[model samples]
Target: MTRLLIKNGAFITMDEEQLQFQGWMAIEGSRIAGLGAGAAPEQEISQASEIMDGKGMLFMPGLVNTHGHAAMSLLRGMADDLALQEWLQNHMWPAEAKFTGDDVYWGSSLAAAEMIKSGTTTFVDMYDHMHRVAEVTEQSGLRASLTRGVIGLCSEEEQKTKLAEAIQFARDWHGAAEGRINVMISPHAPYTCPPDYILKFVEAAHDLDLPMHTHMSETLAEVEQNVRDYGYRPVEHLDRLGMFSRPTLLAHAVHLKDEEIALLAERKVAVSHNPVSNLKLASGVARVPELLQAGVTVSLGTDSAASNNNLDLFQEITMAALLHKGVSGDPTVIPAAEALRMGTVYGARSIGHGGVTGQLKAGLKADFIAISLNKPHFVPYTDYISHLAYTARGSDVAHVWVDGRQLLRHGQLLTLDEERILAEAERCYQRLRG
Candidate 1:
């Protein structure tokens, strides 16, 4: 087991309560074994096999992307400035049909490079060709929860085949790669999935004890369509089908009624709020304040680089804070500290890794990043929490570590071949254009 020590840093542990600043963190094997403000433990200190200086760095738990189509990095800017339906049907889905396993591998590798450079250590991904995505994630040394996005609008036999594929992927990959990869069953959405199919997926999830990930109420059109077709809103329909009885992570959730919010809280469904994607698509802001007040666990996500234009959780954190405040007309809606939590600890919890990661406490996984604070934007920083949430950018990430393995050091990625990945992605893009 590799033992490493990161010493003399301004630690910003986004723990359950708030940030713990100016501390040292130690990693033994793949877990965090020590973290505190004073001197390192003498016994463990002497036994460390390696030590790295963390001066002029703000160390915090790595950002968790609660929801994303990571391989969609290949389609970024190809379908921008469009509504959700137009973007998906005309651009994203069409291009996705041209994707081969190699395309997925290269595209996902590119996404992983961007993520590691931007300090995202773990991500929850839903897309097609997930085996390729899994391969990329494993090789990149990033932790991930992967799912094959299934559209249940197809024939029953097709649905069964897709479901079986997803189950097999889960069985083969979950807890694999030194416990770095987890898998989930993902039904595309309510509009795409019939009630019977949704019920079937839920049953499968229950049988396998796997958590469910899906899109829900991302736009008013989706909700209105659900009501017109089923005489119930999206959440109401899913709840009636017992979809929320299991551990479920819902993406978007931008248009929900008060009753739907209550139901989400009642069932303890986790929500992944994609503020940047929602804003870019003209989707209305989610009722995050209401959801939080109702006791629902809400986390931040970038959705995909195609719609969000980037995979920076710092931007999502700031947007989540300000969007809710402006939408609700309350200044205290989501404070900076709370916004940071939504991106870190709350995000880990939403993806079902809260107990194992998300904090700098002892016995947790050593998944964290070091932000360079020598920049002009972070000057005269009195409160590290506020500065991090309000001023930090992805470019400010100096180093990133996942499971005690340094994936990025001094803004250079150690796990990916960037030029080769970019060239392969460009070739795929040209093929799509043809």
Candidate 2:
């Protein structure tokens, strides 16, 4: 196994202690071997096969996006400034119906390139043609939890086919890509999926023993519709249908009530707060402070480029930190450290990768990024966490590594062909439109 040592770098270890120190970190194979404050020991320096200069760099765990539709990169700005239902039914669904596997591959490739350059090493993607997305994940060297999101609004046979597809995707790809990829069973949302259809997914999840992901309570109208149809709120409706029985990650989770928040905490459910997408679609803000207070794991996500107009998790981090303070009028509600953790460690936990990545600790996957700290936004560096939460942008990411492999170095992608992806993505979009 090759050993690499990086010394004289500032590290934000989002470990159990929330430790930040100027230190040297040792990497063996694909996992972090050791890291500590101050100088590297003589033995480690002598034994290292590669030594990297870490001067003027700030290293931290790569951001984890808990919810997104990666293949929707092609749909960026296609139908923005619309409500969720109109956006999905009239524009998104019709456009997606025309998407072939090749389209998904190119779109996902484009999204992967954007995410890597933006410092997101891990993400949870719920979309169709997931095998293409998985192919992108394998090629891009990004860690991901991929799901075949099924909407049961079609005929009975179509619904079964969709469910079967979702099941087969989970079976075929769960633990692929050297354990960098995992699978989940995802129903599109409560409004799109009937109770019986959702229960089928729940059963399939139990049979496969896989976690589930879904869109839940994203808008107030959806909540009212659930009540009109099922006499229960979205949370109670999903809970009644055995969705909360399995480990699940719910996207948006805006428009949740107090009881719904309590129930989510009791069920140990995780919420992926898509603040930008919610706000863009005129969806109300989630009760994040209350959710955190109730012990629900809250993580950040950019729903999709189509909706958010970008795949920048740094923007999501800043939005999550600032949105809550302004909405609740509590200046100290989500502090810088907490917002940063939500983007990294809490995101890992939400997507069921907590045991392996999300922190710069020994015995964990070497998934992290380095930002050039000499930039003006990072100037004065009084509080690194504050700078990261409030001022940092995705363009500041200078290098990225996942699973001990250098994917981006010196602001250049090492594994992916960014130019080709950009060109092909444009071609794919034109084809879809035509």
Candidate 3:
């Protein structure tokens, strides 16, 4: 097995107790073999052909973007400052209709470059043409869970065909790319998918043992529509159809009611909180602290660059930590350490990789990021946890690893051509505009 060692860094594991120290993590093949303070295991260290000196840097589990449309990087900033309906109907959907496999590949590749540089090793993506997105993720050496965003506004036959395509894609690519990629079934949203269609998806997911990803109550307008049409809230309608019983990931759960929150907690539903996207689109803020207190697993996400304007999980983490407190009028709502957990370990849990890839522990996947704390903003590191949550930026990430492979080293992307990807994305965007 190929071995690697990361030594002498201030390690923040984001474990149950939030452990921190200057330590070494040993990687044997794609798994973390051991981690501790001071010295590495001699056998593991000796076997390492590559060593990463982590002095003046903070090593933690890589950020997990729990929800996003990776290919939407091609449409980023195209329809900003608009309501969600207008953004999607008038701008995004029309632009997406022009997307080809090549567009998905190039756009997803660009998104991968941006995410890796920003210290996100794992992301959950919902988009069309995900085969191209999967190929891009494989080539970039990033871990991902991908879903084909299924909108069932068409006929039942067309919906079945798309669902079959999504299922086939999952069967062929789930656990592919050296086990760095997984697959999920995504129903776009309640407004887009009728209850019967969602139930069909739920049954299919149950049959295939795949997780379901979907948007729920992203906006008040959406909630009002659901109420007007279905006579119940979004989550209530989903619960009525028994969609919440499955291993479900709910995105942008902004307008959830108290009863819906309880339902989520009871069903152990996972939520992806996209703070920046919510704020940008004028969507209401998610009750993250309430959800957390309700025993719901709340993870952090950037949604998509098109909606969020950037795929920076660090910024999301900071926003998630501060937004709830300010909105709830409580200073002790979400602590810095807890916010970090939402981005790292909790995110992994949301995507069904809980014990495997979230933390830097033995038997976990060696997927982590290193942020340089030697900068002015990170100076006087009186509290390492505080520095990580508040002081560190995406630019401070000097290294990133996924599945024991070095994808980013010393602020450089090893698997992607940054300039080419960006230029190709720009070209595609111009074509879409034209």
Candidate 4:
């Protein structure tokens, strides 16, 4: 097996102790062999087939984006500054209806390039044409949890067709790409799906034994609509429909109530907090401090480039750290370290990767990134986590690796052609506009 060693780097291992040290890491094939503070033993160095000098870099686990629609990168800025429903109904859905599988492929490729450049190794995507998305994921060499999100507001036959497509997608793609890809079952949302249709998705999830993902309680308007339609809030409605019966990850969740928070914790459902997207759409801030205190796993996500205008997970991390404190009037809430964890460790756990690639540890997948920390923004690095959460930008990322394979080197993508992706994305957008 090929062996590689990265030495003389400042390592931020987001393990249980949050160990930060100047050390070396050994990679044997696809897994981390060992890592520790200080110089490597001569045996490890001598046996290495390749050695990388990490002297000027800060190495940390790659960011995990818990929720996003990768193909929406094509729709970025296409229709912004609108409410979620308006954006979806008046603009997004119409354009998406005209999307071919090729559009999805190129758009998803564009998203993968942005994610790799920004140091995100794993992401969860829910969208249509997911086979194209999975193809992009396989080619880009990134880990992903993908779902074919079904909107069930149409006729009964159309709803059945969409659900069948979703199920076929899950069966065909789950555990694909050398175990780098996993599949999920998703109904678009409570407002879009009837209770009976949502129950069908839950049953499919149980049959396929896959996790579930969906949008829920993103805005007061959405919650109120759910209450008006179903006589219950979004959370309670979904819970009654048995979505929580599976391991579930909810996107947005900006308008959750106290009881909803407690119920999420009790059911062990995870929430992907999209601070930038919510703020952009004028959605109220999530009760994050309360959610964290309630023992619910809160992870960070960018939602979609159309909503967030970017795929940078660092922006989400910084926003998550600052947004809650500002709203709660508590400076201590969502400290820098916890915010960073939300983007990395908690994100992995939320997507059912808790024991996999969230941290830099022995026996785990070697999914990590090296940031050039010599810039002015990172100077006087009194606290690494603080600097990471407050000052670091995605452009600081210099190198990225997943499964011990280098995907980005010196901020350039190795597995993907960025120029072609950009051109195709533009072409697709123009086509959609017509």
Candidate 5:
């Protein structure tokens, strides 16, 4: 029966018709109870147990990062300026081999702190030692979709063991953490996972009734390698392998053709577009404009801090908005509103949440962020959507709420100890370096 009210503010519902109103929102428990323009219902305000003054703030749905490796925050800036294969093998993979569960816990703690303070309430994470990741997700109060990313480039016995672990993790953690955490089956990528091993993961996902997440067509080299090894591109190869038969989210898809895009749209597969990470890795830009035109669900992802150096969806949204225009040389491509949707509601849909949490409407989860519009950059707010896409940075976020709980307020964390997390992550990094 706990009721929270937010009033006297500028609210962007991001709902159908893309409404903007100067109004308030009421939260009854974890779901939004009411939202409107002008004045709120007197009875709703009177029943509120907690009231937050939203004056001078633009309240909108909390940002959703559809794909990331959360624990890789510990390796941020450690392996930069390298292509995919060299970076993964020479730098990331070797360092990751020495990691223990405690390392993952601390790293994930640090990552959660960064994300919460920056206004990302929900994110999809794929990495190893995911039990520790789940523990942190529960304690941090941030909603997350987590998976044990398996690379099946090992002995047959080793591959079997990894599959068992992935299944066990899916069994124990699906819809866990009071439903704040969701579990997904992840076969790291087409190149890393052989066809048979990936089929086993697909089978597990089907049995568990959960969706799948994986990297696909991230780079030209990877696509060429897929063709060389499998005699077909990843999209067709995976479709042939029955991956598209299940609900799947594919990360990257930077190298795609029109027919491939059409196939993905037909199969109802979603894509996670990591603009900054792809540019940094020289992975090339995704055919986002074409994909969206084909009615394919294209959402935003930051990949990992190690590559992009930050888990800021604002940056990704901005990149998606501007990069497409510059590359396509068309001003009308990926408008600000559409870019914002990709980072928020579209991202929620990609991770299987959709309208349940990514909008400011009644009955949706009370997962939204409040950004202070009092800054100089935000002055003359001719268009809030444009400001959010082109001018806003993560630091402008003043508050974040997920599932009716405040995780960050006044740019500080409420559910986690930031200093301790920073110290522990630093210690872990020191150990890794030593």
Candidate 6:
């Protein structure tokens, strides 16, 4: 196993105390072996096969995106400023229906490129033709949790086939890609999937020992529709259907009530807060402060490039930090360290990968990014964590590593061919346009 060392960098260990110190980190193969402030011992430094100068950079756990549709990168900016139902029905779904496996491949490749460049080392993707997404993830060198999102608006036969695909995808891909890729069972959303249909996904999750992911309570209309159709609110309806029983990661969750928040807390369900997409779609803001206070693990997600126009989790973390403060009229809401955690620590827990890749601690997988701190914006680095949550953009990412392999070094991607990804993505876009 190759040994790597990062020296002379400021490290943010998002542990319980949210500690920050200028330090060095030692890595053996895929796991972190040692890290500390100041110079590492001569023995530790001598043991490294490769040594990197982390000077003038800040090292932190890479941003974790808990919800997204990687193949929707091609649909970005095609439809904007529309409500959820109208947007999905009139614009997004119609465009998606024309997507082929090749389209999924190129689109996912493009998204993976963007995500790596933007310092997102981990992400969750849900969409059709997910095998292509998995293919892109394998080449991109990013850790991911993936699922085939099933919308049950089709006929029984189609639904049966979709369920089979979801099951097969889960079975074939879970723990694949050197344990960097994970699979989940997704049934789209409450409004699109019937109770029986959603139950099938839950059953498949149980059978496969995988987690469940889905859109839930994204809009007030969705919640009301669930109440009208199922005689209960979305939270209760889904709980009754046994979705909360398994390890579940819910997307959006923007329209949850106070009691619903408590129930989610009690059930230990994780919420992927897609603030940018929710705001763009005019969906109400999630009660993030309430959720956090109620002990719910709330993480960050960009939804999809189609809705968010980008997959920058730094933006999502900033939005989560600022939006809650603005909405609640409490400046103390979602402090910087907590907001950073929303995209890292809480995110790993949300995806059921806690203690594996979230924090900069020994024995954890080496999933982290280095941001250039030599810029003028970082002149007064009174607080590096605050700067990360408030001032830094994804473009500031200098290097990224996942599972001890460097994917982006000095702002250049090592694993993926960027030129080819962009060209094929354009080709797919032109085909879709025609």
Distance from true location, Cα of 148 in model 3, Å: 0.7
> lDDT by residue for model 5 over 149-185, one digit each (tens)?
9999999999998889888988888888889999999
Candidate 2 Cα misplacement greater than 4 A, ranges: none
Total backbone clashes of model 1? 0
| lDDT over C-alpha atoms for residue 11 of model 1 | 89
Instruction: Mark the regions of model 6 whose C-alpha exceeds 4 Å error after superposition.
Output: none
Residue-level lDDT for 39 in candidate 3 = 76
lDDT of candidate 6 at residue 371, scale 0 to 100: 96
Predicted structure 2, TM vs. truth: 0.99
Error of model 2, residue 11, in angstroms: 0.5
* TM-score quality measure for candidate 5: 0.99
Q: Given candidate 5, what's the lDDT at residue 224?
A: 97
What CA RMSD would candidate 1 show?
1.3
For each candidate in turn, the TM-score is 0.97, 0.99, 0.97, 0.99, 0.99, 0.99
Write candidate 6's Cα lDDT for 241-321 as tens digits: 999999889998998778899999999999999999999999989999999999999999998899998988899989998
Q: Go through the candidates in order and give each one's C-alpha lDDT.
A: 0.89, 0.93, 0.90, 0.93, 0.92, 0.92
lDDT of 3 by residue, 87-124 (tens): 99999998899999999999899899999999999999
User: Where is the poorest 10-residue window by lDDT in model 2?
Assistant: 14-23
Cα-based RMSD of candidate 6? 0.8
